[model samples]
Target: MDMAETAAAVVDRQADERVRLVVTGMTCGSCSARVERALNRVDGVTATVNFATGIATVDAPRAVGPERLCGVVEDAGYEAAVQSGTAALDTGPEDRAAAALFRRLVVALVLFFPLADLSVMFATVPATRIPGWQAILLALALPIVVWSAAPLHRRALTGLRTGAMSMETLVSIGITAATAWSIVTLFARPAPVRGHGVWAAIMSADSIYLEVAGGVTVFVLAGRYFEAKAKRRAGGALRALAALGVRDVTVLTGDGREIAIPADELTVGRRFVVRPGARIATDGVVAQGFSSIDTAAMTGEATPVEAGPGAPVCGGTVSLTGRLVVTATAVGADTRLAGMIRLVEQAQEGKAGLQRLADRIAGVFVPAVLALAVLTAGGWLLAGGGTDRAFGAALAVLVIACPCALGLATPTALMVASGRGAQLGIFVKGQQALETSRTIDTVVFDKTGTVTLGEMTVSAVHTDLDRDEIVRLAGGLESASEHAVAAAVTAHARARHRELPPVTDFAALPGLGARGRVEDREVLIGSPALLDARRIAAPPGLRAALESEQRLGHTAVYLCLDDRAVAVLAVSDTVHPTAADAITRLHRLGLRTLLLTGDNTAAARAVAAEVGIDDVVAEVLPAGKVEVIRELQARGRRVAMVGDGINDGPALATADLGLAIGRGADVAIGAADIILVRDDLAAVPDAIGLAHATLRTIRGNMVWAFGYNVAALPIAVAGLLNPLLAGAAMAFSSFFVVWNSLRLREFRP
Candidate 1:
């Protein structure tokens, strides 16, 4: 099959069996990428690792199992466990880790302040140098270096065992070497004071770096604490959504007795009762009751929807003021709330293309920095610099070249953007959509439901018979049909209080219309094609009236009696108020707009003209829509398809970027890359605007992260920066990247 055909088939295929793992000890992007690569090496497996969320989504054959995946990650020197229930959204472990780091940071700061003051006293007034002050400094710095940095040491040893290098390895090497040197200096006799030249003074001064060892540990620990906190906040939206579901619910037993049970135990075909201000237990239909439902938590819509008997309600939505007796149709993972949570989790775990570049660089970053540190030490010794100078320069290089910022640059930005998008009622499936949306040059919109309100209503009528009789006869025949246009005619009759005659021998002619005996008169209601097929003759001016209605974008249905045209009913879908302005905004963004529909030429053009669309492609079948997307792609134009129907599914999956209206069919929503939660055309432009802004943020973060490393490395190698300053700069680099990404939270689209 061709590419378009293959994409269409992909949407229909069942998803591959997958396993989600919560991985620990992933300090940088390279660590996560390493786990991902190891899992992908297993037979029949594809793995994606998200560093920001620390989750791995692996798609593997059923034969592989979760144990094998966890084993592979463990072998790669990280910890992994299968995640279930609400464990994926829990941040308790991260919070506990942060709390532990905070305690260590406080201890380090308390001891280092006095130790630093004594070092200054010894340097400024030689007579005030207390005996064994160096020993006292070493005693004070020991716990901060050994105990406060225990986690770093463990991870660093794991990297060494696996023959890999990470940010932890760099930190561990710097701290161990600096502390070991300080201990040796305290026991050995002090070097003699020399000439006042800068190099001679640096060589003659005491070579103790006790403050460097203690300060580096504290700053690195603090950086990790804040990084963990920021990551939790970035994923807070999905966690909050998962928390909205009630654990226990009041279910009405088959015997009509109410009992409390776990929400997961509520199975399909069961009945449940919800009281005022209570959340609906699961996806179900209201059997009896009336209430205003608050769907804002589930759909991001502000207004409450009215729920009555036979109305469908979703899980996690609250009932405002009335009791409801609902029959459960879906429970457990089958509920709409569960599906939305799955989508959000998958989006968080997926990686952007730019992040792959960062991962590649990070994978080699530590090893390269190690090599640079060795060269700096060797070069200093060969140039006649003392061992003190050589060791200090090497320590500075090891402490300064951090890969954390590069690792965090892209994922943090994407995390913030996805969370912000969720709040704005736009669900971005993954980073690919965010990247593709920014470059789209053309947008093709499905006219019905996407641009116009999907609801059809009877707009006008022309007939020789009385209007009441025409509506009554048409409603009788249409009552047996389930088409939208038929429903519109029947609804109009009901609203007018016109009694529908009994419909006998009702037969639905598939694509044409419906025919039946209404009060002993043969009634036919459908398109003009049905009348033509039945050899019916229209009355004078009937053709002109039908043409006029069609010209105004209304569907004209002809009612025939005994093979004679009796009346023409015009049904039209209302255009959304923001449709024209949305088109204008897209034009302002320099994107070409087209209307694609299965409606007739005149009706399609009329709506297109009304909405300010630049082009119209009408009378196209569902399969043909895919070809249109392919043809546009062939012209080097990136296309984003906006649609909201089952027929729009294939095209949506085939387009470069697919945006489905929230009220669309499940199939369309499943195939789309982005979903506009509100059925408003204005969200189309708003989504695109948000995509552009998010991409810009990602690029800006990458530039800053790369620039910092490039500029700092040389200064450390030249011994212009001391180890303590280098450590501070390294920690600040990571914090700066995260703070830059948080700016996306203020995005207003």
Candidate 2:
């Protein structure tokens, strides 16, 4: 089989059993990759590691148990625990880890500063170097190295045991070597101060690298502390989403007695009561009462949606203004809120394309650096440089070459971007979507429920009779039908509070006009074709008016009395108020916009003209929609499909990027790479703009990370940098990458 087929087969085989693991001691992307590789090495297993959330999602055969998965991660030099219950979403352990790191950083900072000052004092004034100065320096460095750097050493040992190397390995090796050399020099005979030149000073065995050991430990600890805090902020959106679900609910029993219970305890077919300002406990249909629900948290729409009898209300939305009796249709993981949270979490856990490359490099990076350090020391000694000089240069080389920056470059930027996207009501499904969005040149929009409001309404009514009388007649005939256009007419009449006279001999015609005797008049209501088929000739002005409504994309239904055309009612799906502006914005971004719909050519063109879309592909079936996307791709156009129906599913999966509206079918939402929770077309442009910004940030971060290592490596090898300076530079490199990625949080479209 080909690569795609192979992948599909693998997905099919592994779809049955999946486990989520919360891993600890992952200092960089390399560590994450290592764990992933180890899990994948197990028979019939596949794993994806997310560095940002510290979560690993492993797909395995039924034979592989969760314990085996955890064992694989543990063997890969990390702590793994199967994520279960509410703990799966909890960040308590991470927060505690961060707290411990912060405390270590504080203690290291307090001790390292004095050690640095004393080292500088001793270097300048030999007289200030007391008889037991070496002993005092060792005393100061011991606590910082043993306590502040404990996590690094432990992780390094774990990596070594697994035959892996990481940033932690580099840090541990450098600090241990420096501290060991300092202790050795304290007891050994001091080299004679033969010359006052810089080379003579560099070769002095009397020099104690106590400050280098302490400073390096302190700097790395501080960097990790900040990194941990930034990662927490990046995951804040998913946590907030999880927090939105109501913990408790009031369910009405079949006998009408109300009992409060946990929201998770409410099952399908159960009835729940929601009062004003209270969140709906689960996804359900309103059984009784009326209220306007604020769905901003779930849908990102600012306007409150009116929910009356039989209207569907989802979980995590607040009932505004009135009480509601809701019959639960879905609860717990089955709710839309739960599905959204899962999508967001999965997105955050996925790695971008560039991140994989970084991980590959990082996987071998520390070992290569170790070899380079060894080679640098051996070369210096062979060139007649003393042992002290060679060892110091090697220590500097080990300390400066940090893979931490490269490992952080992509995931951190992606994390920030995903969180910001969620805040804007755009849920990016994964890193691939964020990367693909920047290259999208064409945006294909589905007409119904996408560009238009997807709701039918009466736009215009042309009738010689009284408008209210015409509406009453149309509503009276349509009240017996369940068609959308019929509902629109009936709803309009009801809104106007027009009373309908009882009709006798009401005869319904399938796809034809309905004829009934209303107050002794034969009333006919249906399409214009129904009038023509009945041999009823429309008046000259009546024909012209009906044609005008049809040309304007309205569904014109002719009303006749006693076999004569009396009125033309124009009903159409209303276009969203923001659709035109959103299309204009997409155009301004240099994207070609197209309307893809199953509507007739005239209707599609009319809607396209109003929205300023450049192209229209009308009268296409669901499969044909996928063909359109494929054709666009064949023309080298990277298309982004925006839709909200089950018919849009194949096209969504076929497009380079798919954005599904929140109110869309579950299948379409599942197929899409991005979800527009606001059901607004404006979010399309915003999502693309944010993607561009995020990609730019990732590129910037990569350049800095790579450039820092390249420039610093040569300087350290030339003996221009000592271990202390190298540690500072290494710390700065990682800090700079993370800080640059944090700038993404300030992004505005």
Candidate 3:
């Protein structure tokens, strides 16, 4: 190819090879600038950096990758790493470094105690001027500046060279200006004063302020470190979501060789072998073998499900005790695991207006402070104020306006609150969920397994002849069905181990009942309609049994023989012991609760009244539940919907915040924003409380962070403080704000 064509192709390749990097050890504008310069110098690399977000994106040749770029970043004393596009990285490392730096800086700060006393003694003792003691004091400051403050200087210079501003930018500017000014005044000859004899200048005291600058540098770096680490740790839920899918799977090749290959390359209808104790490679039916599979990771249930031929196996579920040959139905991003990862990624990247407001304030803060400082100094200088006074004002402006406090406030509290939530078996997802929960004014719950214990029990068994014979016959017919009522009847019969005669010509009528020939006698078990169609007249005793069951809101299955009323099987939904208490708790919290379900109206109303729900939407489909949520939202009510079925996906996705009990299938969890690992209704309250706490902390941090800057900037620019002292105070203030933010770790729901 010609050079022009080759260059065009290279540009196309560059556009396709975009990469992301997480860079650490950045403290000031100089640090960012340095990283930008170093990365740009590498072959075929284009990078964009947002100093506020501390995120960097690079487009480079595939051969010049993130691993290579990371080397360049680390060589400069910063840690550069790659993260998956699938999940948020943890903030653990950054938090630890911040903690370490903070601990060391505290010791350095304490050393300033003796230095302060010495300064006071020197100031108070008018006749004592020991040049030797003064020189010794200056020399003693070597450890504070070089050992303690070096990281800040290094990061600041790097950021400066790379054309970015960071916390180090202000510190470097304040410290360097003060140090140079003091050193020059100490050695240089003073310019001749007009109409006055030249006066010899004595030793300068301004240099003593460098200790403050150095101390501030160390402390500020510590804050950033913790902030970064906490951010990473708070995002652990996203990491678990990312780790759901299989990276590679066994592939049956056309050459008759069974080879392991990347899952992304697997095609639909391709058959593969799943070994025992290994996760299923893709979503497919078991083509061969019989065994139990543990789907707890995907379904969040401890039950090991039995799978036979044609049973759908989701990817990421282990085959605990069985080997099976499976056909690849879905792979890579199409698998259930990938679907969850995509959902989580969308939540992380979708920034709401409220979330971005913090950044907007931070964006304009630095430049405004810098401008104010310049104006303050010039105004004082033009009024015939001494150069020293003007410089002091300018130093205050730069030192006092640190934005680290604002940056760490909300995120730190959010991290702690989310962590506490995870410990309580609740996943808050992100800031959106936290904010949404705090705003939720109404809660809608699913009927089955949500407001109830999700189990069915035999309420009554009525028979014209022997009750045992009726139970045995009905249970034998119901044993073939997987429905709740069938399980209840089968379990009741099995408890007594009653001998059931074989039934021939069995038939199931969904949602109604079943029919079969028992011992050559046609027997039917179903609802009132089936008996009415058969024209069977019930005895007075059977009528009483039906009335009592209906009054209790139990499901009554009528039994008939030879078109005559024979027996009636009664089943009732089990109510959870905690459901009523949870409803009372919600009421106490001033929340309105309602039940939404597809169950019969009578049963729904009974459950709702029993649980103290104010309203019930009965015989409603999954979409109907979502519609109800929307109607409440339209009425200016914030709503939260909790569900655990694939049918609930739409409602779960459409609610203000969808909370899926982790006991559900992977599809359900993927649909909801928050996942409650424990199926307890109490977790709903726990999650809401945690969200409130996190939001409060976020607001608290923002107030401290922004409030500090507002109070400090004016003091800095008015020249009320010297550069050295201003730098130290500014560093300490920022550190204090961050340390306060770290207290979020102790938050509990």
1-749: candidate 1 lDDT, tens digit per residue: 99999987775443468788989889987787788888989988999988887889988877788998899999999999998776546777788878988898888888878766664455434566678777777778888899988999999999899877799999999999988887787677554344466554433343777778887998899899899888778777777778778889888876899999998788898889999999898999999999999988877677899999999999999999999999999998888778777766766777788899999888888999999999999999999887888888899899989789988999888888777777677788888998898789999999888888888999999987788888888888888889999999889988886477779999998888899999889998878788888888787688889889988888897888877887888999878888999999999999999999998888889899998999999999999899999999999999999999999999999999999998899999999999887657888998999899888988988888888889989988887777887899999989988988888878875
Best by TM-score: 2
Give the least accurate 10-residue stretch of model 2, judged by summed lDDT.
198-207
**Model 3: how far is 201 from its true place, Å?**
20
Best first by TM-score, ranked: 2, 1, 3
Q: Per-residue lDDT tens digits of candidate 2, residues 165-243? A: 8888888898898888877766785333334665455334225677888989988998888888877877776677778
* Position 3, candidate 3: lDDT: 100
**Which order, best to worst by lDDT?**
1, 2, 3
lDDT of 3 by residue, 71-142 (tens): 877665567778654524344555566677776677556665565455434433434546654554455455
Cand. 3 Cα-lDDT: 0.68
If scored against the real structure, what TM-score would every candidate get?
A: 0.90, 0.94, 0.73
lDDT of 1: 0.85
Q: Which residue runs does candidate 2 get wrong by more than 4 Å? A: 1-15, 86-88, 191-206
Better of 2 and 3 by TM-score: 2
